[model samples]
Target: MAKGKKKKSQPKGKTITLKMAQNSMELTVDGKRRLNLSFQEIAAVPKCLQKLCEVDELDMSRNLIRKIPDFIDQFVGIRVLDLHSNYLEELPVTIGRLQNLLVLNLCNNRLTSLPNELGLLTKLQTLHLGLNQLDTLPASIGLLKELRHIGLSDNRFTRVPGCISRLNNLQKVNLDRNPMLTEDTASQESVMISESLYVVTESFLCEHCRKKLKNKKLEISNINKVQFIAAIVANMFLGVKW
Candidate 1:
């Protein structure tokens, strides 16, 4: 080895090709505001996204991202955030600001614990945390009264988190592949949700309203009246445009 020679520094992040962004980014689509940055191999969330204040969906899955930026809270209208198949070890505290968020997919990450602010996603219905290293969940998770589906399989749990029992609206749960869980316990933990859960895709959901109808019993008219009034007050006080 030469005494004076220094090794070359590694590149910090990967770049998305212009063509890839052009084809996948929803900036060209007039009806919906989405940014599909998935499978880009990037190591960080691009700073350009901070300009999109009305983004409805952002997919950063299948990347090399290690940490979430605090600026993510600025997307006040965001309803779907996909960060699956990333290298995330922890989430940013600003994520709680996504008041309109309904779907949050963090599958296949390296997370060992979730932030307490996660409970602030009161409107969230579908939460995917499968294929992670979590053994326990924050007690604040019980605050998610609207949550219906949760994926916690392939983690380090010895027993089901007690918070799951508090979710009266939860209809679907997955606790598979945990080493310490018995077959009997797995049967007891998993819920048999109706097909209506899968039938209500995020894309099919109401865009501006963003209210979730759990089953056939709820009327869209009723939800619109109540949610509209509440949304008006929230917008006026919180400065949120949703």
Candidate 2:
């Protein structure tokens, strides 16, 4: 595979049309161009011939990319990389090289696992990885201290990756589409609290509620009454206080 790997880091000499933005970039790579890319192109790095273009966001969705190019490590300035609606089966280990990347969209693909290197991206904030074939996530994902949002929808995951709960900055998580994600799981809660035991008190969980809770669970008015009655009865018996 290394022999056929395209030289992704070198700049190209061909001239082409350009569209520009400070934080985002859009490039056209048709077969008509000297780069000679196809409609079902699996990778785009070689199509651009190592141009020294810089952008914060890139949109290469609706393609046939089977894998992330090893050459993408050169785009250190990029913050968002959108590769949704592709045929990707795997990600490149070099993906961790995008240290500044914040949002990475890999929806509607065929990925099975993420590279361990992905955890090195400490600055990444949002990761959209729904609609894929991923069975599990890298444990190293917990290292992304800046991560705030994550989408694990429409995948083959049998269980939620416990390491994800380590993200203290996370406010919202989506596991709505995974069929294997059920309500009762002892190991699930343990893995969530193992990395941050003190954070359990700060987290949102309903007491005496069999089902999970949303924000409205806090509105249960009988909370104090239930606790008071239980404590009083326990004390009246054998000095047992719950």
Candidate 3:
């Protein structure tokens, strides 16, 4: 009679320890990156996390964490940090120490204000802070020259800070669901319209605004075609002259 195959033994060592440390925490591997901790009901950061210096991504979303520990700075190599859907009311100033961070998600929290030190993340590309209670942003935000996308929807802002326009690399901004924005300022065809920038608001577009926005887009498209034709003609002329 054929014997039943032996059951595969469970993997051991630190990998197993991390995988089985807490029932609330789920650890998974993605390539060479380690899963520090995530999706747990933890109210505080674990001390063991400080030893994970090589970890590049840490996802602690959907937890009950109320405060960020200063030891977070110890994760020097972290590039992406996801702390969404937590109970965080404020951030530790040490957050700025994550100089290598590229993406930060703090959406759906209880944050009412931001620390100026956040501007220290010069390499940050995407920042999400929607569904918070923030009323103002620090001027230092302008220093993030590499930022491409920012989410500020569902916040308490009467007007967007002028500093946002200074970010030359910004491609999209979400301002939907903000109650303080005036009808004129939040209009779909307002001066905020641009060929490269997209702004989202909660208000409905009027007939006149819709027409204006459509015309503006058509005008921009025509200009682009004209420039492309001009370049082709110039190239042909150069070939003939040569």
**Top candidate when judged by lDDT against the true structure:** 1
Report the lDDT tens digits of candidate 3 across residue range 1-242: 99999999632212223434433333455554645455656777666666555677788788778889999998888888999998899999999999999999999999999999999999999999998998789998999999988998877766777778778777778776664544777464333221222353313467888888889999999999999888889989788432
Error of 1 at 174 (Å): 0.2
The regions of model 2 sitting more than 4 angstroms off are 1-44, 181-242
In order of listing, the candidates' clash counts read: 0, 2, 0
Model 1 ranges with Cα > 4 A deviation: 1-11, 16-23, 27-30, 181-242
Write down the worst ten-residue block by lDDT for model 1: 192-201
The residue-by-residue lDDT of candidate 2 on 91-166, one tens digit each, is 8888899998988988888888889999999999999988887868899999998888888777766666888888
In model 1, what is the error at residue 74, expressed in angstroms?
0.4
**Per-prediction TM-score:** 0.69, 0.61, 0.67
CA error at residue 100 for candidate 2, angstroms: 0.6
Of 1 and 3, which scores higher on lDDT?
1
The TM-score-based order of candidates, best leading, equals 1, 3, 2
lDDT for model 2: 0.68
